[model samples]
Target: MIAQSAARHYANFKGLPKGRSELEESSLMARSTTLAFSGLLLAAAPASALARDYLVHDQKEYRAAAGAVKAGDVIRLAEGEWKDFPILLEGQGTAKQPITLTVQTKGKVILTGASSLRMAGSHLLVSGLVFRDGSAPGAEVISFRRDPRSYARHSRLTEVVIDRYNKADRRTEDRWVSIYGSDNRVDHSWFAGKGNLGVTLAVIRPKGQPEANRHRIDHNYFGPRPPLGSNGGETIRLGTSDESLSDSANLVEANVFDRCDGEVEIVSVKSGANVVRSNLILESQGAIVLRHGNGNRVERNVFLGKAKPHTGGVRVINEGQIVRDNYMEGLAGTDFTSALAVMNGVPGSAINRYHAVSGAEIANNSMFEVARVTLGAGADAERTAAPTGSRLTNNLITGQDGKPFRVEADMVGVTFTDNVTDGEVPGAIPSGLRKTGIATKRAANGLLYPTDPALAAQGAPRDLRPVMVAEVGPAWYPKATGIAAFGSGRAVPVKAGGLEAAVAAARPGDTLKLAAGHYTAEAPLRISVPLTVSGPRDADIAFSAPTLFQLEEGAALRLEGLSITGDKAPRQSGNAVIRTSALSTVANYALEIDGTAFSRLDSAPAFDLIATTPGTFADRIAITKAAVNGLSGAVLAAAAETEGKGRYAAEHIAIADSRFEKIGSLAQILRAGTDESTFGPELILRGNTVVQSGPVMLGLSGVQSILIEGNTFRSSGRIAVANSVGTPETRIIDNHFIQTPEPTVTKLYPQGSPRVLVSGNSIGGDAS
Candidate 1:
């Protein structure tokens, strides 16, 4: 972004004062010059003094070739997996002719497994390379500076794909791209599955850096970035708390943010003079938040929420901000996550805290829902200052006629002028926004445009269109998705052979249809991809492995209609029918076992039917229409390492329409008592028939919510459920007990939490 045109664009933007034009000038210049600049940076040398191609096949050769790099020189890497190579390159080139570092062929070179790319030079272009299936050697996947003191200027990274290249632990923080230096660009790359900690892309101003670090990020495809379950999950972040008052002049344009629900702030702008425009947000349950910056513009972006929960448009805070010409619809967020939320600021706030909004403009935008527009958002103690000297002007809002706007602040020093809405909004002046009947039709580009001549011009600029998958990211990426599944659901027939080998060969999302024969498994069946192994109930596996099956943390597996024996399970306790790998300490899990049966050939009597390791936990464990006869372990179990302090392991445990006969104690299924975390450590045991089970033991310490309904317990039964120290909800209804022959009584509630509903059940010969 350090191009001359980019610098001039900032100076040329209309209505922006001297310091405010830095971002606008750079953004419009990047959109117009990036394509032509790509051609210039990538074209072969001009048959002049600087033109040469250095083809490197190894780390040693690349180092030697980089030393001699010059203007218009092409340093090409051989096509294959280059593992653990740190390609730190630096060179100088002219604007007309740049230094090129690329692969022999597009999308063919794989730089994976601790490999990295760092550049510190002028007019450099890095393209057509992939980094995947491994983590970076350090914190950043790619760095614009070779070191802290040196940085790359006026460089470009395009057609590069970083897919599933991550560490096993989700807490390991590392950004995919970290921009430094001045006027650098990253475009047309495919970045996905950034499940680990850190922002997907970050623009940083290292110490002693220039005032305006103009960076351009455009036309990239940001794929499914699953929630990080904590802070530091923004898909793209600009600047930081320390640099809040400085001008970044960063430009983010025409990219597709797909399902990146990592945190409440999708694009956290923490610095000043940045422009975010023409971007499309699809089903991501967060917003572009002007969290700490001033003199920032959020414009021409299309937010298509489709009523998905938590989806938002833009949230404005700080000062001298403009939120304009954006089209938002079907957003279902409120307060801080509202489609357009102007927040209350903390008085005399610190650098990291929210500051008061002054001289802010929210103008010429269109919204289809009332929940989308929220004024005076996030009002609480210590944040008593409301927005002052701000205007919401000439915007169009269409929603329910009577639903009142969320007005938390008193709206001091605020003006609502020439704003139009179809409803009689309670917060806004009724006379200012005249009511109208607005109808819209889909344009050729599949976007709705207003039929009313006046309203049509009030929303986002018509020139901005919804970004398609093809327009962003590398052309050769295998998958393009917002929330696409892990696999394509294709079936690969499993012939008579080693089932382990077959599982390794199968692609992700593929279903392996097992043949009705003896499949030998001498090792743990390691499933590192999403797969479904299906067969009839007659199919069996003679697994002599440490564990029957081991799964990569994010990988999902479905076992259907098969039989397995677990007597060979190791006494050292690697025994698990399906266990997540310990390589990753923590992550969410998806496991399904349907119509499958387990038989132990020996009398071990102690086994783990399904288990989780110490630090790892599952979000949802669903076992439906299955039979675990002669079971020796809990259906699901994990250690409550931090028990009684609030955090229990799993989110949801569901075992439905199944049968458990001759099974051992299920006390370890859920034992964390009085967990404070909401939405789970919940268990749903419905429509199951238990015979000769281990007394139906749910110990004194239990889940937050337990529903044991429509179950038939015969000969030995009682339900003891509660949160000893915390309040819990337990519903035991519509169950039939043939004989109440169990030893323990069916009550475990403590003094604090006594909300257990045990109704509509028959304890004797009657049915309730």
Candidate 2:
């Protein structure tokens, strides 16, 4: 009975559903009679009979020409290999008569399967086919699942080439491509050793469902991956399962991933909007990570490989993600090992987790030459602690002797201006060199005219004086204003003061204006070249010597204005401070607090200024229009630990219109060590004024593009913007905090932080 005439010819082919299932018919003359019967079979054939040339030598002539395809057909595939069974081509085209299954010539067409090549409905178009050896470890070489006796909704897999067909030692199996359903278009395909992700768009039952969302993955080329499924290098992945079922919208452009293994996630979304741009990633190991989808947009794109230092280059745990102008180079492997990392209130939540990445803008793009940590813990912890506040303007990082590597990492509310670094000047890793002023004599243009040709070519060792000029005042003599006079050699006298008593002695670079009456000195004025030691405006410059300003180890000090104070020892904490010693380059260290004030200097129990070495030359500290009334233990402390490396290395610094009222215990501004190089250890605290400085004003440990604009802090001290350091690039813009808060008032310790851009700030604290 031949199964009762094949069930009466499948019930007359299910009442002639025509092609592309008539775009799911919904009446209207049955979709205009299925687009007038596929436009009368392509206007009455002939163009090689409407191009339907199938030649699959086995599997029963490929399911008998896919049940004799009709509606505007174009199934071509004639030059070779075929093994895995089902090519169930649910043929039914009508959205302008669709149905194109191509691969006419370019040889090698192997679609070996246990269950794939399953196109279940709607305007199908599977182009340039090449599905190889399929091992079906679980199946899905090419799918479009959404069947309930379906009538094709919307299918398309262009340039289709699902490689290694089923994997049976085709060099260790693994190839997958799975699409749920909804206006699909997977263009220019070529997916090698796949699945667990080479291409995936999951959403299998999450309740109310319905929103497989429109899709379009452009310019495909996802190679390499199978050495260990899902390593997270990401070639393409949207929807990793949060199960509320809203696969909303999609569109990934310009694709080109070399060794994708994992981490390009995009889970939960109650809304829609996706657009990943440019694209050109190589050496794949880890990158392109995003989660908890929300109006997404990642721009430019050019990431180069070998991730896993917590795999960076892209990591946004979702909250309105929008990282711009991307260009990530690699270097994040020190091997501490954490495995499958997914931070931010963790769980089995694999990736894309965001509720606060709000409106991102990581601009510019130029992580050049990346790779400084040569053989474990080098370049001092990746230039001090990488990532903070996102916007990090105009980047151009370089540092492997080529010079320019100074970033301590905690960039709060980031907005660093015009950064530039030429490289290699950061020394002190079991190293020491600090002695300026060596002139034995000899130069008629023999090059060592030391005493300043900018310190004579840096190697320093020159001698030859005839350019005398050291008088101090006439605008403090340096060629009497024509510049070039930095301690001109050959004039060794003072030990008893004579030239008008050493011109009222107070050396350094020499600038003792004085004048408004009130002068007392006990012996503390030992600087070498950079000095301001001001007075003149209603004068008062007294130092009963307990330690007023003694910096001797290649000093570069600046102490504007002045006001004296008497006895204070434990080693003279800080009243009129500026000291350097122990191997130095006081690196443009400025502490100008114009109104000039400070009491007891932490009652003299020791440190107020220790000079921890960490330099690339940008800024270490600059308190402008100053005022620090009564400090104890910490008005400013820059710790340089020195282990693997990287904490705070000077770069571009600015501390605006300062004023720290009652300081006790610690921190008005303090930066700890670990900088290798990036030249952005920037700090700009505008219109500053801190009432009770102790619960932190700036405690950055791994600081970066820091800029806390429009400052105002009242009575604070417990982590008031502390740099927790796992990775902090902070940016706390337009700031203002009152009543001295922080009984755990969130200032930042957000796990492995890299980008923090808190817009236009204002907090209330003081409830503890």
Candidate 3:
């Protein structure tokens, strides 16, 4: 029934069917009746008996009227583009007469360009709004709770659409929808294309509060989220690790999570007493982890992996968590990050660390084609404490994989009973476990059930109850039999005269296939949307201009199977072939150059890649399977233009499986942040060959973790790696340095920074 309401809310607009149009003539009276019927229901009164109605044509009028809105008042936004408008709604209405904010003509009022809404006060309803083609810098697109004031109580946000709201660097913390306060509901909304940082929706528990937030997030569509490659990217997070002990009493039911593989722990339940039931989690990379808190219930959910690697199932931790009646099919994860992982807790763990799983009940669940199920995972080293007083009973597991279960040595005080598995169960399994074969088939009600009457009667049914593929995403998504709606878009082919023209004419998800020939760019190409430009191995791009590419805000550039070379321009000074500026309005940007080459750049200090926007930053930059040779300057130079208090920060820079030869000064090979700001905690230089003539191969400051492994460095330099500020962990291991100078790796501020271990490297004949 709740799902039906969500469907109705999404299909609320009259004469506005998606992707098509039909002109329908109606009298003024009929139009008025339709408009009034869409208004807020006041005290169970009929639509004609509403107190007052105000038509706001623009943001200016909307703002003015929003300040003075009263109970039983309905404000209708006129049809047009409301760009970068920040709406702060504050009103108090009785349950009988709630305040409403809606559109006059649905699907016609488009909100773009950093537009957002912050709802305050109680008994408020915001519905039938569309937010797309924009991003909110350092904030959520729609927030029901603001800092220092949680005013949204008994509020509802329905029929809302937040699509493609992203940041510039993809590292800044933000969300699409943040629900706070008690008795609030977010239903039937659609959230798609949140490729950057932050969750799609988060239910935050206010600090120092004992009462649970009691929010209901149901029937919403959580769409595709690309892997963020770090922590803090989840589809739905109930609470943070800090508030793990707080009872949220949140109910997340009947929602569809489609390909939401943003990071590990997809639907993270960090709080206690929450219920995650009857939902469909499809092909996501992470499982629904009970990371913290206690007494949580995870039941009746469907997890479909379809044989993808890292696709997960329930991962249990903490205490008093129940996992039952769930169906997992074609899951591939094993070991600690396995299909059914009952993690080994750390002894005397704090609130933030992994706590022991006590009083857990894994009962009556069905697993098909799972790689491995385990208990006491990660108990060997990190998580040394075993779970206590846990029961695994009456679960039916059948697969061809021989290794069905792996119980670690340290696991003790576990009771496994009546669990039937047809595969080769481990020898250490408890005594009462049985090996049985169960027959199953699809029943008339569209659910898989055990055909054998005895198996069905024993409550140990073995059935891979697959979710209807057509019923998987947003309610209004076009139904295709046996197709997942979240993974349904196809890239259109684009052909143009030049790269810049192709990028300008192409849509967000279009692919431009370049022919195998040399292409020249007179001016730098500006990219403001996510695009993929690929070609054959023989294709190349030559840059005559000072800068070859200029990435704007919200742009993601991927270049593969191509070579990029710089022309010999003598007059060019202190410029790069590819550069980024801080003047962009968008927050996050991505640049991926793979299987490419950069050579013959004769300019003085020829910086091949320069990302130095003073106040702006990029999320990820990856250069792999490429070669950099015959360059006078550093191959990669990234730093904030301005020094001191205004430096840009980039995250996740990976240069792997590549070759660097005949480079200018080894000191200039890789220059990460300036003396002021830090680049990232993760800078990976692995499986590469670097041959330089100068003193240094890498220089960094204010970094966190640097991995320099499995590389051959042939240099006469003084230092292989140099750091100014003290980093936490720098591993210079497993590298062969030939004909190197005095110091292999040096840390300038050795006292402040931790020591960089220069071991496992055959430097100048002996391991250094």
The full ranking of all candidates by TM-score, starting with the best, is 1, 3, 2
Ten residues in a row with the worst lDDT in model 3? 18-27
Tens-digit per-residue lDDT, 79-102, candidate 1: 888998888879997565577898
Residue 601, candidate 2: C-alpha displacement in angstroms: 40
Query: 528-635, model 3: which lDDT tens digit per residue?
Result: 666777877667787667777777765667777777777643356665666776463334566787887877765556555554454345567788898877776666
Model 2: weakest 10-residue lDDT segment is: 471-480
Candidate 1 stretches with Cα past 4 Å from truth are 1-57, 78-81, 207-210, 369-374, 381-384, 398-414, 418-437, 474-507, 510-525, 533-549, 559-577, 585-589, 593-768
Question: Which digits, one per residue and each the tens of the lDDT, describe model 2 over residues 294-367?
Answer: 55665555555444222234544334455554554453421111111222323333333223333444444444
Every model's TM-score: 0.73, 0.26, 0.70
Which residue pairs in candidate 1 collide?
1-183, 1-184, 2-183, 9-25, 10-25, 487-509
* Between candidates 1 and 2, the TM-score winner: 1
Candidate models: Cα lDDT each = 0.73, 0.45, 0.67
* Model 2's TM-score against the true structure: 0.26
Q: What are the clash counts of all predictions, listed in order?
A: 6, 85, 10
Candidate 2: segments with Cα more than 4 A from true spot: 1-98, 101-118, 121-143, 147-156, 159-185, 188-235, 238-710, 715-726, 729-768
